[model samples]
Target: MKSTVEHLSPTRVRINVEVPFDELKPDFDRAYKKIAQQVRIPGFRPGKAPARILEARIGRAPVLDEVVNAAIPAKYQEAVVASDDVTPIGRPEIEVTEIADHERLTFTAEVDVRPEFELPELEGLTVEVDETEIGEDEVTEQLDQLRARFGTLAGVERAAQKGDYVQIDLSAAVDGTAIEEATTTGFSYEVGQGGLIDGIDEALEGMSADEEKTFTSTLVAGEYADREAEVTVKVTTVKERHLPDADDEFAQLASEFDTLDELTESLRERIGQSKRMEQAGQARDRLLEKLVEGTEVPLPESVVQAEVDSRAHDAVHAFDHDEDKFAEFLATQDKTREQFDAETREEAEKNVRYRLVLDALADREEISVGDQELTERILFQAQQYGMAPEQFVQQIQQAGQLGVIYQDVRRSKALIQAVRAATVTLPGGEVVDLSDLLGDDDADETVEEVPGEVVAESAEDVDGDAADDADTAEDKADAKA
Candidate 1:
């Protein structure tokens, strides 16, 4: 067996492979055994018929066909592995060129390959992020939130307004046909929260207790999804939240701190720490943008198209792959199918470019994802998708996406390395030290567990409000108890 590679373009290659008949003995044997089990021969048990006798009965063409079918995939993989220059990024398009009976078999495979490029000097890169300035207003806002958590809800005689909680009955109909699933009795909602029906907030703004109003909104889910419906909301009761005064007694009631001054100081420190984390995130984004913009990467058309197809498929999958339904769903957002496709393609191109650039940088920096790093990434993703780690691993393995996850982890670490190497400064031109947020230079240390730090967990953890919400909920429960 032999193989040679042809450079079709900077991002693609064509591999020509020749396998002699002697090298194909294993394939031929397996093919014969498989065919014999299916084709019955008199005087021979199933899968016991000799190859020559079976071929004599079925003809040489069938045997050759079976052998070629079984050999191509394995041979193609061998050819790819043998060529160090070919790092295929997408599926190959293979074509069998010739089959000289008793002599040799030949084929050619065209595939998208990773392009080679030199990475720019990362150490010389500089990016500016917003100054980390924790304002008193921010601390006050957090303090107010804490107070609101322990606040009591009291009946109000006035009209419902933003921040007011209301118990309401809702009923909806599409084209005068009532939707049973869309009706709910005694649903409690915050007046200003817009996550419910789109126009409900405005409808409830000036409605007093026992007041009813009818408005039009599009049903986002259920059988009548994406269709406009008449929604009637009746305010059964309106209540306002009364926060306790920010005094020493309130502080003792709300937190571990015994005095309001101590609590205020802690709130200020927490806000400052949060602001610094935000700055670190901004710095990372800016540094990555700079790296991507400063580098030139040849995008593989096939790879980009595959990503675009995947995204488009996911978008329409919920609609059962019905283009018309997807179009109607997009129409609700004031987007046309053409516009959506254009945007999807644009995003796919940008993603592919970003990946290619980061991959090159990873190679230049000799970045590697250890087993522990990979496991940590897998665990994090599993938690994100609300699945057990084992279940997520099985799913990704079935989809052949475990390699994708590995690459993602590698790229993340590479970006972190780039962030560490690049100089980050504040808007005021003062150099910012982000070692606490970016983690130390020790290669064995995982970024997911920075001591007493909140920023270095992961890329998504930088903006993690869920953890903060959980902490707030626990504190509130403790204070109430």
Candidate 2:
């Protein structure tokens, strides 16, 4: 058996293979054994018939066909393994060029493979991060939030206000046809919270208790989604929250701190920590943006198209594969199908490019993900999906996505390495210390910021958002059904 590779393109290759008949003994033996089990002769028991007898009983053509079918995939994989440089990313198109009876077998396989590219140095990348400043306004806002948590609700006689909690009965109909799923009684909603039907907040603001108002809003999650429906909301009762004054007593009641001054100071420290974390996230985003813009990573059209097709399928799957209904749903977002598809393709290309770049960097740097890191990521994802780790793992395995999760974790680790190698600076000319965030506590270590402020971007942000949109759309479709 022999194999040779032809460089069809930077991202594709063709492999030519030749297998002599003498080398196909194992294939013939396996084929004959399999055929013997399937075809039973009167004189011979199953598994005892000779290969020639089996071939004579069935046609020699059938045996040859089975051997060819079984041998192609196994031989193609062997050829791929023999040529280590060809890292195939998609299925190959195989054609048997010649089959000289009992003499030799020849074939060619064309496949899309990962493109060979040079990796850029990550150490010289610099990016700008927002200055972490905990101000009085931020602290006050935190204190206000804490106060609101401990506030008491009292029944009010006036019109419902923005902060007031209201008890209401809501019903809706589209074209005079009642939507049972859209009707609810004695529902408690806060004015201006803004998550319910679109116009509920505006309609509730000036309505007094026992007052009813009818408004038109688009239903988003049910059978009536993307359709305007007339909704009638009747205010049963309004209750205004009365917050305690920001005094020592209130501080003692709200937190572990007994003094309002102590509580405020703690709040400021917490806010500062949160801001620093935000700064770290921004720095990472900026670093990625710089790397993506500065690096010239060749994109594989096949891989990009695969991602685009997957994203588009997931998007329209929620409408029961109805393109027109999906277009209507897009119209609600002020998007047309053409525009949505264009954006999807662009995002898919960016995501594919980032993945390839990160993978190359990981390989060049010899970065590897450990079992603990992979398990931790799995656990985090489980929590996000509100599932137990074991159940999530099972689901991922069922979907054949365990490799995908591993790749994602590896890519994230590679991005982390890039971030560590990058220099981050603030507008005040002070270099920000990201050691705590990066888990490197050495104060003397200096990561020079990028020469200019660069925005960091993540492939996960693009792909994850696409996934979330698909999940949400599917959930809505299920609920409507």
Candidate 3:
């Protein structure tokens, strides 16, 4: 067996392979055995017929066809593994060129390959981040949040207002036809919370107990999804939350603190720590943006298209792939199909670009992900998806996506390395150090799991399933392997 590579472009390659008949003995043997089990020979038991006798009865063409079909994929994988420079990023378009009955078989495979490029010097790069300052108002807001957690709801005799909790019965109709799924009784909702429905907040305001108001809102799900409907909400009860006074007794009840002043001080410190962590996140995002903007990454068209198609598929999946319904859904967001496509393409390009750049950085730094890192990533992702770690692992393994997750973890670690190498500054021109947030070299070597953290800004967060798209592309590319 022999193989040679042809450089079709900076991001693609064509590999030509030739396998001599002697190297195809295993494939021929397997094909003959499979064919023997299906054919009946007079004096021989099932699957006991010899290859030559079976070929004589079934014809050479059938046996050769099965052999070729089985051999091509395995041989293609061999050719790929033999060539160190051919790292395919997309599925190969394979074409059998020739087959000599007793001599050799030849084929050519064209595929998208990772492009080569030099990374910019990370130590010289500089980025600006937001200032980390915890104001009194911010501390007060945190205190209010904590107090609200321990607050009690009491019945009120007045009209419902913002911040009041209301028990209401809701019913809706589209074109005078009742939507059964849209009807609910004794549903408890907070005024101004604004997530239950589109216009329920405004309809509930100023409604006294046992009062009802009819308003119009669009049903976002079910058979009447995306359709405007008349909605009637009857207020069964209205109640307001009452918080305890900020005193020593209340502080002792609410927390381990001895006094209200001590509690307020702790809240202020916690808020300050959160603000500083946010600043670290800002620094990571800014640094990544700078690196990506300054670098030149050659995009692979097939990989980008794969990502775009995946995103588009998901965008329409909720509508059962109904284009008209998807268009209507887009229209609700004031977006045209053309605009959605353009945005999808732009986002796909960015995602592919980010992946390629980080992959290159990881290679340059010789970064490697260990078993522990991979396990930690799996656990974190399982927690995010609300699945057990074993269940998540089984699902990903069944989908052949464990490698894609490994890539994600590797990319995250690479980005943390970039964050440490780059210079980050506050708005006031003071240099900011993220060593504590990023952890030391001797520590866990993982980024902090703060909200809006730097690692969260990666391409995986773009559509929250970009990794799935990448997994699909990788599965296609390495199908034979």
Find the candidate with the highest TM-score and give its number: 3
Residue-level lDDT of model 2, residues 1-481, one tens digit each, is 8999999888888999998888888989998988888887989989889987887788788887777776766676567666757666554567889988799889997766667687667777678888777778899999999999999999988999998999999999999999999999999999999988899999999999999999999888777777899999999999999999999999999889999999999999999888887787787667767777877776666777877898899999998889998988899899988999999998887877676676666667666657776687788789999999999999987664665666566656666777778778898667887777766522211222222211111111112212333223222221221
Error of 2 at 397 (Å): 2.2
lDDT of each: 0.79, 0.75, 0.80
Which candidate has the top score in lDDT? 3
Name the regions of candidate 3 deviating beyond 4 angstroms.
442-445, 448-481
Model 3, position 404, has a per-residue lDDT of 73
Clashes of each: 0, 9, 0
Clashing pairs in 3: none
Q: Provide TM-scores for the models.
A: 0.88, 0.86, 0.91
Candidate 3, number of clashes: 0
How close to the true structure is residue 429 of candidate 2, measured as C-alpha lDDT? 68
Candidate 1 residue-wise lDDT at 175: 88
lDDT of 1 by residue, 1-481 (tens): 9999999999988989999999999978998999999999999999999988998999889888878876776676666566666666665666789999999999887877778777779889999988767788888999999999999999999999999999999999998899999899999999997899999999999999999999999888889987899999999999999999999999999999999999999999888888888777777677777877887888888878877898899999999899998988799899998999999998887777777777677777788778988898889989999999999999987654566676677677777788889898877788998788778654532344211111110011001222232222222221221
lDDT per residue as tens, model 3, 393-435: 9998876667777667767777788888888887777898878
lDDT of model 3 at residue 481? Answer: 22
